[model samples]
Target chain A: MTLNRRAFIGTGAAMAAALAAPAVRASNHGKPRVIVIGGGAGGATAARYIAKDSKGEIDVTLIEPTRMYYTCFFSNLYIGGFRDLSSIGHSYGTLAQSGVNVAHDWATGVDREARTVTLAGGAVLPYDRLILSPGIDFVEDSVSGWDVSAQNKMPHAYKAGSQSELLKAQVEAMPEGGRFAMVAPPNPYRCPPGPYERISMVAHLLKEKNPTAKILLVDPKEKFSKQALFEEGWNRHYAGMIERIGPDFGGDNVSVNPDEMTVDIDGVVEKVDVCNVIPAQKAGRICEMAGITEGNWAPVIPHTMQSRVDENIHVLGDASNQGDMPKSGFSANSQAKVAAMAVRGALLGSNVFPAKFSNTCWSLIEENDGVKVGASYEATDEKIVSVSSFISQTGEDADLRKQTYEESIGWYSGIVSDMFG
Target chain B: MNWKHDRFWGVLATVAGVGLATPVVAEQQDARIGDAEAGKEVYDLCVGCHEVGPDAGNGIGPHLNGIFGRRAGSVEGFRYSKGLSREGRLGMDWTLETLDAYLENPKALVSDTRMSFDGLEDKADRDNVLAYLRQFSDSPQNIPESAPTGRAREVGLSQETLAIAGDPEFGEYLSNECTTCHRIDGTYDGIPGIVGWPEEDFVIAMHAYKRKIRPHPVMQMMAGRLSDEEIAALAAYFGDLE
Candidate 1:
């Protein structure tokens, strides 16, 4: 088990489509219906927790496009060859076993006032409570010349799975001394430490396979999560191998010409053997379609994860504009537990505990060099804020780092079991 | 210049978790203990096996309601390990000192116990967990007087690790595991609470648990895991809470 955030986001809810439909399960048990629009970390966990805890009291229906989910958290380890792709992928069979009506279909439209969801398969499902944990989506036109059409050429392995495979193949195929470039995303994105970890993983691969090869990081932000630790790791493990250009050096204003296989940074174009263009991210499009979003993300009450505009809907994970919490799988899972408790209390009249949340973000710099940052949070009148926090220092010993890495493995196993089983 | 050794030095100076090795001889500052709030967080690790509170029941492990002062191996339907049953025959109660010893090394205290957990390593963690445990009991066991002020005051229970009084808020998070056996709001089945006791009482009980004076294998193993700082923090949290 490794670290990765797996988002369960609805496909295209709010965009009505006409296709031959299968009859979606209606509320059969006279129980309140919970229609979860995604089956990844947040959605699946909420569905599982609510359904299992309710003991057949509430009906849970999970709609997801893919039967298998590839976690975005540890997909970097796959590229670094620490794990296989199969290990990062999970199925929804476990959720179904827990009595979740796992529906494999696209969520095309939503009638919020009507409290109904239209599926691409021509099914209209009604709900008493809708939990929308649609993961992130690239903000359209945020990066010039790098659209969905150009994904194959400049893969944003940020989504995991096939994209991860593609990027790995490209890295493996890079000619000796060839240049590899990355177009990093802006702040407040999924997994703040993600790109830097990817950089470390790539550097690990290149160091072993192609020592002479170089990596160029064009980062929009001047600083990043675990900057000091990452810098130290890079210097120790891959010194003189990776170079980063920050905002002051025009790293923010950048574009990739897929047609020419070049990254134009500050009026300078650099042709590379491979390129990773991670565009700006936003709340899942379904959130915007449901009219729950203010700018790019849906806002929710911290304690319950309920939408500010509509209490019937709850948003979690990357789609929700939660203060001080990262948009990672751990965060999503924690939020889901809180939401599940609140939802159970609302629907089943169960006792609801005051919302308390905690999250830890772990990143591997090398094989056994792992660093972590975590905090416990409480929902205040204004927002979810940190109560206490801890981080790995710059000059930790191998034994401690090894222990930290082991702790992450334990967390991964614990979370994966919690989410899927 | 040595990357690996620098990390080694960093570990010695770690601010959180079990032991640290920075020798500081400053002013005699008041020793604040673990936050019950933070102990709640650390208790998350134990949730999978144990259950606490009124709704709590026997899961993978026995329900930990009314644990302190309750006889060992006496959770009615729960099958106690041979060592625990033997200790129960000896009429052992869960004193804080005994709990500290048992948590520090469960297997060493009670061999062949059914529990699969590794004990806490930080003294603060053990003390905080014990404090968190105390929150569920109406009448916790009496605190031992004139106990050796735990090396935990400045150093961890372990010889190599240094200890610090942790934030109870964080301890609350760490105590997620403890809630599997002991609930936070003073509800109990087989376990007990320290929620309303003074911090000093909680600390003495934990030292008893750690020294194996009380002979429950589960407590021995669980106590073994925590450092002095963690125990101190737990005391502050559970003792200060209402």
Candidate 2:
């Protein structure tokens, strides 16, 4: 009567009978339980869908440290002045009202064998299924001379809350005509186009606020997400204000001194007014504690999103080594639904459908000038693979770009509603 | 995704004889119910290219035996048009509503169906022909003498046939993809409100996107993957929203 993954996947009647068995009766009285760690795009969507769709049949608990979730997707817009900080923040109240037991606390550790998660508040909760969508965490010491202790001096602003506000304040506080330097992360990080988009927003702000300020971008990668389109926009709008040093030109060899406010590229050292350091990222530490991650990420079964090491645990979003899809909010949201369906089918004996995933990423270069890239994905035996894709073309009409920008606004409203509500 | 569930229920009802058909059909009231005796005469239009019943096999078109709940273009050894094969890959299925649409206008459904017969304009004739064909199929709504048989891929669809009653349960699952970018609360910001549109308009607009007649790339990509039945389901789900 263990009701392991094998019993959960048995025929509907057998699974139903197992749920009715007395030995497995829980505090909720025989209802299957799911515990979700992290409450961003992936975790929030997964928790809400399971609770919303199960109709009180299953108990769902969402453990997130923040009561108000600030999305990283539109934080750049806040930096650029297109949106306010309040506009990008959402609360778990709606999800709680809709049946998810929202627990606002940090998940400190996971015990896979006992199927329990320990919170920072010293409460231990058990689960029939565990979903880890904790997003990205920086690889400590990956960047020389920089660590979390140095964050106050040089903000990463990658997590999108206080750090975003801090970054914006720093940019606004820069001295006239001062230099702004960004140490961009290497390949395999969150949001493929994020660093470039931030640069666009930063440039937009400087053009209006401090016209003569200089921007120095040091990249470890040879090329980035939307290189041609970004290059085209940068040249068109901020022609002489920005400079980039790619890996071919010693950009890969970089170090920053937060105390001195200087950057060393290969051997040359230069002083800068502000520094944004985005280090290499890995799956959040909870995945490592659960012993599910391989190297930097947790590998999952493409169809169910279940961790390869343990069937009862599912890894999602920026944390999972899913193929072809970018590490964006949209991809995580899409993956959440598939994982929710699989969990419901396993627990509630409900029908399961094939996994269909899609993602679209939009970046605004300047006022009313936005571009996008998107693709549709299907789960194959080995991994989720792209089936079809589309991207915005260069030199498009202003009207089209405006429409794309407006469309992105609509998308933000839509995705936030999908996540929070 | 829709067809897999349908096929699962179809197999369960056929093999277990477990009285699962009534609930399935009750949930989908628009499925296979008409005067089969009258449908026999209306099916004469299809006699030239298609055949059904015990001795039925591939003809000018694939045989219609066990057509209900069957995947489109999936008959073994029968060469199908590229358009129909593509639809099959896109997850098209042969269900009661889809059959009626195909009977009403073959080109409207597949856009390139090889059958050149003029469409039946009367809804009664289409319904009766589908009811007549239902006798040869193995849905829970009908107890055919032979077993249910067909390969399934995925997808659901329809054409200009406006009377389709989509299964909202299936729509709820598919709507997850839509709610990501389109608010379920019907709030319009940069994206238009899709809630409460007439089912007919919803179906037509989605078909236009599927055909690339619509201008938006994201919409075209989303609609292109949906089958006729899936379109009908979304229309039903959104049309009824408050």
Candidate 1 lDDT tens digits, B104-165:
87887778877877888887787667656655543200111111111122222332222223
Clashes of each: 119, 9
Docking class of 2: incorrect
**What is residue A30's positional error in candidate 1, in angstroms?**
0.9
DockQ of each: 0.02, 0.10
TM-score of 1: 0.63
Per-residue lDDT over A181-233 for candidate 1, one digit per residue giving the tens place of the 0 to 100 score: 99998867888888999999999999999999999999988667778899999
lDDT of 1 at A301: 74
Worst 10-residue lDDT window for candidate 2 chain A reads: A1-10
- Considering only chain B, what TM-score does candidate 2 achieve? 0.47
TM-score (chain A only) of candidate 1: 0.93
Candidate 2's C-alpha lDDT? 0.80
B165-191 in candidate 2: lDDT tens per residue? 234566877888898988899999898
Best-fitting candidate, measured by TM-score?
2
Q: How close to the true structure is residue A308 of candidate 1, measured as C-alpha lDDT?
A: 80
